[model samples]
Target chain A: MKAFQSVAVIGLGSMGLGMARSLMRGGHEVRGCDLARDALEKLAAAGGSAFNTPAAAAHDADVVVVVVVNAAQTRAVLFGPDGAAEAMKPGSVIISSATMSPVEAQEFAARAGEHGVLYLDAPISGGSARADAGELTVMASGSPEAFSAAQPALDAMAQTVYSLGEDVGVGSSFKIVNQLLAGVHIAAACEAITFAKRLGLDISKVFEVISKSAGNSWMFENRIPHVLEGDYAPHSAVAIFTKDLGIVSELGRKQSFPLPVASAALQLFLMTEAAGMGQDDDSSVARLLAQIAGLELPGMERSN
Target chain B: MKAFQSVAVIGLGSMGLGMARSLMRGGHEVRGCDLARDALEKLAAAGGSAFNTPAAAAHDADVVVVVVVNAAQTRAVLFGPDGAAEAMKPGSVIISSATMSPVEAQEFAARAGEHGVLYLDAPISGGSARADAGELTVMASGSPEAFSAAQPALDAMAQTVYSLGEDVGVGSSFKIVNQLLAGVHIAAACEAITFAKRLGLDISKVFEVISKSAGNSWMFENRIPHVLEGDYAPHSAVAIFTKDLGIVSELGRKQSFPLPVASAALQLFLMTEAAGMGQDDDSSVARLLAQIAGLELPGMERSN
Candidate 1:
């Protein structure tokens, strides 16, 4: 692989910014654009070129990585005001890393193809920590040409890149499936911790036992500390699950399948969001449950 | 703890038989009873006395460890014809190892007190293998005397013994809390695997990606292999969750707290059971979901 290639990272949010730095660390000449002035300034401070529009950042780049929020935002970055797709050189690859439905991924692939640009459906996992370390897991699929084109950037951004055949949309399907379990597990962790508190258990003891026991999940071990410490900071916000599980609910209904566990979890996130904690960490549902149950959870004695 | 004490094991099923042998390995004089003559003979072969009834088994025992099925069976062995509680000497302890409601445990503790016996509300976790190795985790509570009397037996049967307090019901409450998470995780794992199948991805690949991803759970890592290999053998049966989650539902309603995720998991177990897999491994819910979606799961081409 070439030690250096021009790469455009179209968003510099938590995940995208870490990925931008990771790309630079991997010796890629990185340029990025974001609506947030601070984010663009941060990328510039990290010695990468920063721009206000996707077109300007992606201009003359070998690869354009769209790390925006959903299908619509990804679409916007590729085709909207001063979008990257029309400006990206022919044969250049567009690596889309949004958590969108397979159908949306397929649509974007076709549109990118029409612009004579190769499109790789690449959905990433691992939160900001992994993203910063260049250790995210990438679920990706596209033409072999696209794979070859995206190889250097993919190597820079991911610890694991699954080449899921030459079909588009498959990577998104895998991502949505992952989001389904991730969402449900998060809600279950919230439910379990609050339920433990209601039982008059030392909630911290519950965490220790469950961490070693069969009840444990990545979410349970990773997210329950927020509840124990009474911290509601958005390590990952409750609104993220609302969006992801909404994608799952939408996709499941499209297939005529029921997602009882995930849907129940969605209700919890939705309920928490409605209760005004959508911006808080997803573990805030535990607080919501505790508040409703008239139980005082740790770190919650002072709060309403 | 004493190296030698007369102990009666009231059940000799998978978990019970292992506990009995573990106690014997700890140098206890173990006497046990079970309806299975093979179990009784196995104990005899191990040089422990195996009687036909609880009373005969409990005769002159210093500790009577009741490892029966539920609250009712525990009551049957302790109070019904040829009951162990009456047969046990006064001041001896009874360690109850059934998954029952806290209220039932409290009631049993009260009744055992009437028989001049100290009752320990001790519910065991970790499966038969752990039991056989004397490495089970015991969530236990009772009086100070009950803990002191049960210590030798507990040391024999468990690697980790949690003295939840002097209250008889707290141990059961902790166990129930553990069950709530365990059941929901199992169901979510099943849902994820089936959803992956519907997405037309390699199901084993889903396992590989998810094992390292945030979607992972103890149940997912432990149970998804059964689905991949298409083996439905009961490592832990589906009926167990139906029963355990039933207890959770019962207790949650009693506390007036909604258990939506656990309740969803209970419905999946119930649906799988109704489809005739109650005795199969809890992961059998994955097969049920595949069957509904008309997808062929591994090792399932031969079955209806």
Candidate 2:
């Protein structure tokens, strides 16, 4: 494989830090950038270069993986003031891994094309732990050239890379579609867990039964354990869904399509954010439901 | 294995037929009854007894499996005009597998207790295919005597039986809770598949990606193939969720709970029914979304 030895990963939060480490593990020369000094310093301590600005990291990088928070930050990292797009070589590729709208991804790809740089609409999943293990799932779409150029870094990072298609927005569209299901499943999991708790069934037993039954989801099996343990650590925060579901609702609105399930789930996520649990783990959504139901879960008191 | 020498399955729908055959295969003398003469005759030809009414089948049966549509039918079969509750022997066990509200299930159990007959609040899942293979999952709750009485039928019909508790309503409550999640997941699956199709991506490819990603759902993997094949054969019909989600919404309303996801899913199923696809497979809810989004699915000529 034609490997991209110099890789830049923007936004050195939990997910970005893991991707940077994975790239280094894959024998790539990696530069990580973030706004937080401590996060950058930690990356530097882990045998990688750390930069305060995106341009500093993107310079001479063959592949850039943008893992920022949203469309605004992703745009800022790529084409904002002293943006990385202007500094990258003509043949270099940008693998955008943020959960953004299809329109924004399409715009980013178009502008990147103007600079003669390939753009892959790649949105990362499997959370921070998978990112750290270089085992994230990448829902990706781009030209054959872009896939070829990004293959080394992609191989270094993702265990499952879905080649959505050649259309720029299609990959982001799939990601948005995916977020709709993921976000809804998490809230549904919250409702089911709290409902079982309220019904006086054993919460852990309910989890075990439902996980084996048809009621299970990837989110339920993953998130309900956090609720059961009463751990609110931010593996993936409630704020992330606040952003992802907002993108889903916005895209549905733009298309004049009514997404009641996604809309209801967005409202629940909004309530979670409104209740001041935005930074808590997304499983904190169960806490919101428990608070509403006036019930207590195992290993935890009532949310109120 | 108390050995159900003579068993009567009171409904011969998709679930009941498979269950009766499984019981017959388990060396039970199976008697199947249904209002439909054709269904009863079909079972009779398969080397089991068939009756036009419940009275003829329940007179001397040791075990009775009631797999009717919902709570009302279960009530009608047990207590309505010409009901079989009066005809069954004092010690015979009645296994009620209808998806009902906890309050209703409790009332039925109490009423069955008055008849000196054992009642098991047993709700089965895993569709007809599993039922045919005797590999269905049963969510059961009842007294020890009721469990002991129902064991022959349960063992013959289910590969996994979750003994929720020894209370009558607990099994039904768990099933309702399961329905809440199952209904929401099926609706979410339809929404995701429709959203992906509208974005001009291949439906099969999206299914492939989402199944491997965090977005994967039990319902999505189980039901999307019906949509891809353009086969609306009623594995589970739209009207099934129309009733199940309706029951869920009713429970939420009565309990004053905010079940937005379940309620929204109920509304969508109602819409799917109103579109005259009530008897079609529940996966055809994807066509409802496709109609709204103005996208054509494979094997369907028009977007609508």
Candidate 3:
């Protein structure tokens, strides 16, 4: 028999909303909370109940899924005024799904443990589409009891849940390492494409050639199409890297690890954000490079 | 009809030796030369004629493929004392396959043109294995006459020959862009894996996850196994990226293009080289990071 528990989903953004629907699809009762009334309405239309705040949603929930942006937002959702943790049942599991530092995850886990709540450090990847399909890859670490408590919700929302270690912070560490590479690859892709344009090579042909060449990366293959078509629409925004690579930079500083490559990528993201393309597609780092070089990329001749 | 030209492969390194054998397979007469007597003997054993000097090999050959190390070696091979260009017929083609700056390529093309020799700025990729199989990727640029002259050799040695532009230097420019991304991705992969080690996650499991995640790169997938196995044998050495990214940095400086990410990668490669692993596999950058962070990567607990 499948024991379907009541789940509270905080933050009804793209990933969060998809995760909430997946939980509902898994036959769990979902109570969702977000600042946007329209997002709440969308959840209601999808047969899930919606509340105005996280605490209201956390009430009576057996597992609370926190899918906010960073450690601060997560802290706000759980411990701010009328925060969910104050209202969450003592034995409920809190699945934290923010891309944050391991130290932050550790701190949060300790705070949650004080309330007799199980905290699972679970950071998700595979993007929004995978979330919709309940196929997100979750890098998670927690106690055996926390994993046991969160297994059903993990099963519903993730295709793969990597039980990284018994410690609460290891998942965040793994996720940061993943983010470090991801940010660097995106920046490298942008640098290559823009540099190709400067060299008078056809950017599209360069893409095709490099896709088959050892120069290719997952980000290069996925993100360069946006450059080829001059699509600046944010499938994933420049600000996203600015945020994620910012966390990477922060962690590197705290750890005293010299992250020359990832830090360079982070600065480029910061530069792209400063140029006012923060909300544009992450590939807009190419646009920034093109702009700086006074070269025109495809479709946007006036951009230079 | 296949034009069976007499092809001289100068500098019969692994790549050159492979091209020599491949030319023989294409029904061309192959004359090879190298400083390494064993390499020359390998060509001789493969039914190709071998010479101790490039000039001797180039004599009476219709196409001279210069598969040398850099612009300086390529210059010496083509125009040094009793050089191949001086020995070759006026109308014969010179396919220069060195990773050089565009300026250097243009200078060589101009020099070759004075001798009535058509020069193709052709830099090869796909490594020794691909070279052995006659499936390398050649990013080439030259005049139409140069293309027409070198097409047989190109067809024999390369699975794909990208005719980047009509100008001689453009091919070098394109190759530099590709190299820039390739080097950065390698360094980024090293940074990521070492960071994963610092995080206390299973490095092999991190590899398995990131290979499927968006963080993956061609270098990451192709090179991390070396780190996992603690094998640092030079499949592609750290020195290769140092040279390549050095060219990229030079090109960026000449063009006033900011390559912060690539430059960061270049520094990491330089650091890895400085640490006395210059001849080791480029994945040795991970070993360097592991050393700095005092973390033990898989397959070597004593390394820490």
Candidate 4:
């Protein structure tokens, strides 16, 4: 198994930035790219290379990881007018780490294969903290060669790497399924906490107890504190779920699947976005619920 | 505080049956009452006394715990033609353990107060297994004297007791909020897993991977296995959520609160019930999603 020596991370947002740092810590020659010059300059200041275009970073790199927002951004990063696929060397691997449709992943892989490059459908989970700690969980699938090629970077960036199957689209399939639950759980948790608060129960007490009960979820325990602290800062923003659940609903509809619960969750997230809380942490969905109920949320208490 | 030496339990279904056993284990002399003769027989065999009427059970009881199905049943047990409240001595405490609306709870307390009895609005969670293990969670609120009076049985039956406040309805309110999340989460999990299976992703692998991911929830991790094993032996039944979420919607309607997410979840559970899985485990909601999509759930292959 040949080790990856140079990798390009295209997208210098919170997740992308932490991933680039992990790659650099793994002793790879890391090139980071983003439209934001300040983000690129920050990466360069941290001793990584900065490139204006994804193609410049992917031109001679052994691995190019695209961590942009959704399928369109993923497609643009890989095959846009000056996309990375057109400049990548033969046998170089493209590890798409964004949340995208499984069908889109299948198409992306086929396009990469046509350009004589490998493709691994790898969508990451865990926040920036775990990403920076090199302990994220990666749901990954690809051809054996792509897996072998991506192993070093995968090992450096994740604590748990689920080797789903040799099929490129399956990883994305699993990841989208995951996002459906994750997105819904966050919205549901927000609803639970805010509803409790509306009922005049202590928010901290509800958290203290439910976190230990079966009513709890990973998202519930993790996100309720943000609601309690009245901190709407985007650990994971409502806009993210808007994109991810959009992918989920679109794919579910394509398959003629009735995902009423997930669809309802998508609607709540949409309401949150429409109410102008889209930039806030997904927990801010609680505020939207409170608004619709005519009950003032703790954080939004002063607004009235 | 005087220790409760003799207690009477109303209702002998799964939850009540388990509670009777836990009370016996806690060294209380318990008399169990329910309309079902067989359930009462089982309780008698399990070391508790059995009575045909609540009045008979409460005749010599120090504490009376009503674990019936709903507000109606609870009212019937407490104040019907031959109710426990009519038979019990003044100052005997009643722990109402049914999932009920806040209005019903307050009315129940007022009615109990008229009988010179104390009422603790206590709605239990953690399911039958926890009930059997004497490790249930009780969301309880009442007058301090009522809490003190119910402490012995509460200690016996619950691992966690959330003291909501002096309000008679606060505990029921919290339980309703918890139910809103629990029902939505379980349904969302079903939707995601069935959606994944419809896409032809490996069901076991999807469960294995997603359970460790952010997508994981208390319901997903616990109930998806029932879907995987094709076992829907009613740990929690589909009809349960329909009833609970109905309470939520009814409360919302009365309060003029627009509960979009909770209402949507209520509809899905109602659909699951309408699809003839009403008696099946709550996880059977997963099968409903697959049925609507015209896709075969992987684990149900055996039944086919």
Interface RMSD to the true structure, each candidate: 1.0, 1.0, 1.0, 1.3
| Candidates by DockQ, descending order | 2, 3, 1, 4
Kept native contacts, as fractions per model, are: 0.71, 0.73, 0.82, 0.76
Off by over 4 Å in 3: A1-3, A299-304, B1-3, B298-304
Interface RMSD of 3: 1.0
Candidate 1 lDDT by residue in tens digits, B1-304: 4558999999998999899999999999999999899999988988799899999999999999999888889989999999998888899999999999989999999989998999999998999999999999998989999999998889999999887889998888888888999999999999989988887889888898888888899889999999999999998999999999999998889988888999999999999999999999999999999888888998888455
**iRMS of candidate 2, Å:** 1.0
TM values, all candidates: 0.97, 0.97, 0.95, 0.97
Better of 1 and 2 by lDDT: 1
| DockQ, all models | 0.77, 0.78, 0.77, 0.74
Question: Alpha carbon lDDT of residue A266, candidate 1?
Answer: 95
Look at candidate 3 and tell me the lDDT of residue A210.
Answer: 89
Q: List the pairs of residues colliding in candidate 2.
A: none
Distance from true position, residue B289, model 2, in Å?
A: 1.5
Give the lowest summed-lDDT range of ten residues in model 1 chain B.
Answer: B295-304
Report how far residue B33 has shifted in candidate 4, in Å.
0.9
Q: Which ten residues in a row have the lowest lDDT in candidate 4 chain B?
A: B295-304
Candidate 2, which segments miss by more than 4 Å at Cα? A1-4, A302-304
Instruction: Score each candidate by Cα lDDT.
Output: 0.91, 0.88, 0.90, 0.87
The global Cα lDDT (0 to 1) of model 2 is 0.88
DockQ of 2: 0.78
Please give the ranking of all candidate structures by lDDT, highest first, separated by commas. Answer: 1, 3, 2, 4
